[model samples]
Target: DQQVKQNSPSLSVQEGRISILNCDYTNSMFDYFLWYKKYPAEGPTFLISISSIKDKNEDGRFTVFLNKSAKHLSLHIVPSQPGDSAVYFCAANLQGGSEKLVFGKGTKLTVNP
Candidate 1:
């Protein structure tokens, strides 16, 4: 069974508006959640992350929220710009050791000018 899932395959937002991407997980053992942004021809770059101990984490215009009880998480981008358009993937893993990351298919976000 797929442990991670991105229910929305895509999202669209007007420039300077907010963009929200949702994700859910079935694994309760996952403690570290991460969001990665991928450009068309490049590898995914780490965006933001949250530990199970924290409910939220933010960096600049990007924010990540985790609800451990619901096994759900979300990424929020405020004042999204056209350049921010890209595919975002959600990943989860155990806190330590050689655990591998389980990634969601990805959600493509389009920021319109």
Candidate 2:
């Protein structure tokens, strides 16, 4: 069973609009959640993260929300820009275990100008 899943394979948004990506997980042991953005021919870069203790975390135009009870999470990007187009991966890991990250397949976001 895939512990982490991004049901939507892709999403499209107009420039200066909002982009939302969804993720789900079956593992309840995950205490930390993260969103990473990946570009073509490059590795994924950390975008934002949230601890299980909090429901939301934000940084500039990027925000991440976790619904622990539902085993779901989402990443919201306000005023999406062209450069924001990329594959986004939702990752989760135990707070103090082996520090390994489990990632979803990824959601490709296209920010059209």
Candidate 3:
């Protein structure tokens, strides 16, 4: 099965603090991973991505780490802000030719000021 999973359904954090979200996968064929941030009534926007070949990738306040051996991944948001309060979906794709993506149910991140 091409099932990608996010075990935690939600997370909450105080503003200016760190927020972490976790995900897992059962399929080893997955080659590319992505994190998408979505707001109410809006489509998810591409946040960051890491190739299966890399263990870590970072962007400004966001960082993603992939552990291929464990079939796990995580996203860390530093100094979380109120604007960051939304649903985060961890997704994966086969990469190369097809565009089919598997997404988790999503984690609702609440940032309190």
Error of 3 at 49 (Å): 0.2
C-alpha TM-scores of all predictions:
0.96, 0.96, 0.94
Candidates' C-alpha lDDT: 0.94, 0.94, 0.93
Candidate 3 lDDT by residue in tens digits, 1-113: 43898877889899999999999999899999999999999999999999999999999999999999999999999989999999999998885653588898889999999
Candidate 2: residue 25 lDDT (0-100): 96
- Candidate 2 vs candidate 3: the lDDT winner is 2
Runs in model 1 lying further than 4 Å from the true structure: 97-99
Provide the clashing-pair count of each candidate structure.
0, 0, 0
User: Across residues 1-113, which tens digit of lDDT does each residue of candidate 2 receive?
Assistant: 89999999999999999999999999999989889999999999989989999999989999898999999999999989999999999999986763588999999999999
List the candidate 3 regions with Cα displacement exceeding 4 Å. none
TM-score of 3: 0.94
Clashing pairs in 2: none
Model 3 clashing-pair count: 0
- How far off is residue 90 in model 2, in Å? 0.3
